[model samples]
Target: MENLDGNIDLKIKEISQKLKELRLSRGYTSYETFAFENELNRVQYWRIESGQNITLKTLIKVLEIHQISLGEFFKDL
Candidate 1:
């Protein structure tokens, strides 16, 4: 896993915005609901969605829950 050392802050903002939009579009009422539906721990998912610093492994997992493959996740960036 890359340690998320470069552009970490920028990436956080970008990912946070995208996650917020995706959650709203999915009609998810809260982080708990979203996490449950996505098979993630609610607290961990909340942290990621809020752009708090996290491990790359967790980041990849969250992206997967969002149905974003590694390739697709980076193509736009």
Candidate 2:
């Protein structure tokens, strides 16, 4: 069970990293610019991408901004 908890944490961090990569790949070189153009809170998005913490709603909002469905986001995971 403890291992399961650790695995969840690791996965969360991986998701965070992927979010950052996605932004970069989409030509948003700066996280701030991405957040601004997407009308998101810059600091909050930064936290999400930094693996600090994030909520499902926030994640959904980000994906929606990118026109990415949750299914597409998780397809390769």
Candidate 3:
């Protein structure tokens, strides 16, 4: 079986790419703007999107900022 770290790293990279695509689709061309609009600091948002440790609450907030439903967020890719 893949190691735990490896599995998490793969998942994080996958989710991070999707988040970035979603942001781009919304015309959030500026990272600072996206962060500010979402009420999250740059570093925290970076960590969350980049697949660093992210709280469930943070994920929920990010999804909400993009006006994406929780069900959609969790939908299979």
Candidate 4:
């Protein structure tokens, strides 16, 4: 169970890192700017990038904003 928990945590971090990379690739140096431009809650977006818990709906919305499908997002992860 502990190992499973660790794996989950690692995956969360990976997702967070990928989100950050995507933001950077889009030329947004600040998460705040990205969030504001997208009309998302700044704090929530920050938490998502910080590896905090995120809902599937929110994740999907973000991916949509990035023009990336779930398959593409997870392909290299």
Candidate 5:
């Protein structure tokens, strides 16, 4: 929650938590390492996990890295 104030929305928080869980489930214990290994900007990836922002392209890239399809990502949303 660094750099983020109290203005985040509930849905955003849910998505953030989901993404974090996804990373953990994928066997990544540290977000920094994951981002670095995946060639993503560590701060940008952290912001996405923090529910700050994420473009569709970024989402697709992340899902690809996780071996998850778009349907699967949006399945429970």
Candidate 6:
């Protein structure tokens, strides 16, 4: 169970890293700016990038904003 928990943590970190990378690729140095421009809840977006648990709906919304499918998003992770 401990190992499973560790794996979940690692995946969350990976997802957060990927989100940050995507934001960077879009030329937004500040997460706040990105969130504002996208009309997202800035604090929540920050939490997502900080490896906090996010809902599937939120994840899909972000992915849609980035024009990426789940397959592409998780491909390298």
Top model number, lDDT: 4
Residues 1-77, model 2: lDDT tens digits: 99998988889998899899899989999999999989999999889998877888998998887789999999877
User: Which regions of candidate 4 deviate over 4 angstroms?
Assistant: none
Rank the candidate models, highest lDDT first.
4, 6, 2, 5, 3, 1
> Model 5: which residue pairs collide?
none
Top candidate (TM-score): 4
Please give, for residues 1-77, the per-residue lDDT of candidate 1 as tens digits.
25666577888778777777768777886889888988889888888777887787987877776687877777666
All candidates: TM-score: 0.69, 0.91, 0.81, 0.99, 0.81, 0.98
Candidate 4 TM-score to native? 0.99
> Which residue pairs come into collision in candidate 1?
none
Candidate 6 ranges beyond 4 A from true positions = none
How many pairs collide in each candidate, listed in order? 0, 0, 0, 0, 0, 0
lDDT (0 to 1) per candidate: 0.77, 0.90, 0.80, 0.99, 0.85, 0.98
Task: Kindly report which residue stretches of model 1 are placed more than 4 angstroms away from their true locations once superposed.
Answer: 1-7
Q: Which segments of candidate 2 are over 4 A away from where they belong?
A: none
Residue 43 of model 6, lDDT score: 100
Ranking by TM-score: 4, 6, 2, 3, 5, 1
Taking the tens digit of each residue's C-alpha lDDT, what string does model 6 give over 1-77? 99999999999999999999999999999999999999999999999999999999999999999999999999999
Q: Model 5, residue 43: displacement in angstroms? A: 0.5
Model 1 lDDT, full chain set: 0.77
- Winner on TM-score between 1 and 4 is 4
Backbone clashes in model 2, listed as residue pairs:
none
By the TM-score metric, which is better: model 2 or model 5? 2
